[model samples]
Target: NITTDTLTIAGAGLISTAMSGDTLTISTTATADQNLWATFNADTGTTTANTTTDTLTVSGGTGISTSITGDILTITTPALLNVVEDGTPVLGGNLDVGASSLVKSTNVILSFSSGGEAAVNWTDISTALTGSGPIIRSVGADTNVDLVLDTKGTGDIDVSTNKIVNVVNPTANQDAATKNYVDTTTATTAQGTLADTALQNIVEDGSPQLGAQLDVAGNGLGDGTNLLLDFVEDASAVNHIEIENEATGSGPIIRAVGADTNIDLKLTPKGTGAISVADATNYETNVTADDDIPNKKFCDDTYAPLHDTINAQTGTTYTLVLTDDGKLVTMNNASANTLTIPTDASVAFPIGTRIDVMMIGVGVTTVTGDTGVTGCARLAEQGILIGRR
Candidate 1:
């Protein structure tokens, strides 16, 4: 019922409109400086558009792609993309950064743990390295951290065929010394010659011959406190002389040690020089002097009669041995007994040897001589007999 002029189609510069009979027709057409599609910014502000090409393009950014197949639009992401939103990224395989360095901002720690053991942490401490197990650590201050190298079990850090250079001179007794320090401090002369100043550096030498007299000065030839000198034979230590210093006591020992069983320590004086023993203050008991240093027994036997050593005999006939000199012989037989004194050829008795005889039983004692004997005596009871050789 509507007429052509009475019905109108409104188009907002995108389509053309008209009315035909009972049908209202609308068709898209290009307007002045107008296109179907327009390029917009991120803020939804329209920027520019092409009038001839009114295509809406769907492009992709890095690690992404888009494709349109018929009426389907597909967007694809990267295949190796393991990262999730606000989470740690874990790769299925090894992460290889091609030709790039993996940089860290702080100290790196390499942690290790066994079945029942605590975790061992090895940390990089900028200038030095440290371990939580303290197997190897830096000792000293931060600026001058002393590196300590340690081994576990039979493990060894072997620097094969490589020389350790730039080593500082050792200060302590057990410290490691460098070649330069050893060469400079040990010797200044040629091959076999050793300088006098280098004597302090030589700890031990096999068959070391002194070029001059060794002057020990006030320090002497010892460790200053104990063992003064040691003499060894073919790597076997035999004797050592020790000087025992006393704090407040008067007795200090110059001890000579013979480091073996049943060994004699002898001090031989140079020809005809007497061994002078000074300060004979104290008396010693149960001591046997090898030399003829007179003891109490010798003094009593020579000067007194109260301490004569007795040689007791029980048989009827007894022979006087060399040990019977200066000793009393007592015969204790029930009958008469004969004391036979052998000649100097059989029993060589020294000159002026004297022997005393006593009859202890109800018997008579007679002192008889052997084949070439000179002195003889007969006594009814007890008497003294002196023999001369």
Candidate 2:
């Protein structure tokens, strides 16, 4: 049995009455003013009714509650003094809203309108704030973002203060010769090199006089001296030695009067005595009695058989009186002209005729046999006839 506050039943011209039971029941007949309420401990109270229609009002307190029986209920929450539309509100440690679904605010739901059709729709929250017009970004500050005008493929990247460095357009018929590099700061212009006939003609000299001193001298960097010729000998080694001809008859005569044109041999004695054709010369001698046997060898130490044969035509004779390597002396009588001896006189001469042509210190003295004849000969001992015929 709960007791409520007093009912202020004010009826005009009718008696308000209640049924006698454990629960009080009041009835309003017509145009009757009856209020059933409960007073709380601090002017905060609850009004509950057994019927479905419950009207409750509160003023100047923290909160109020009421119970009614309809599915459609109108809840009036106070307009918050400090309102943040989509802010989270906490009651101690629990969330005051959205225990079931994510609660979106009216601004969020209005922006979620897809073009124009609007129910409460969910949309993606952009992290950017909008201005009145279109959004813009700077090319330098925008990382990983590409502008629409960028080229399609990858190209070489370089730093450029001027225009972009590209493969300089190949000139007309451009090749390595036609392409050139220039330094613009110095204002130097480089004309491209080309291989043309005219270009070659500008510098080419086909037959150059090489080894000209102008070509090899004086371009710096090394030592240069022109030391070029000077090496061997020739035919005119001696001046006047005529050994070419003998038949000219102008050659020197042997042991005769006007034949002393060259050197002659006349024997002289070592001891002072008559040293003619007779001397004990420790050698052999030969004599022949003939009127034409011109005063030739009378006695000689060379002991040659042909010592008496000084009249041989163009032949050499020798008398081995002394060897040049031993204690030997030699005397030579040479003929210049070719001797014309008869052939029978050469056949009468013997091989071992003991007539001398050389001696150790003396010369020839006498002649014995006939003078021989020959064409060309060598003297094995030491006398002389004609040199050669």
Name the top lDDT candidate.
Answer: 1
Q: What overall lDDT goes with each candidate model? A: 0.62, 0.34
lDDT tens digits by residue: candidate 2, 210-315: 2223444554322233212221224442222211222465643333222236544465678887544434342233333454221224323233333334311223
- Name model 2 segments beyond 4 Å from true: 1-36, 39-60, 63-78, 85-99, 103-389
For each candidate, give its TM-score against the true structure: 0.27, 0.13
- Candidate 1 C-alpha error for residue 242, in Å: 3.6
RMSD of each: 19.2, 33.3
Q: Model 1's lDDT to the true fold?
A: 0.62
Residue by residue across 262-377, what tens digits does model 1's lDDT show?
Answer: 55557789989966555333224323566547555555544464227998888999999988877778888888889998877888888767777777777777888898876677
How far is 154's C-alpha from truth in model 1 (Å)?
A: 39
Worst 10 residues of 2 by lDDT: 320-329
The stretch of ten residues in a row with the least summed lDDT in candidate 1 is 39-48
Candidate 1 Cα errors over 4 Å, as ranges: 1-201, 204-210, 220-225, 234-241, 259-261, 278-389
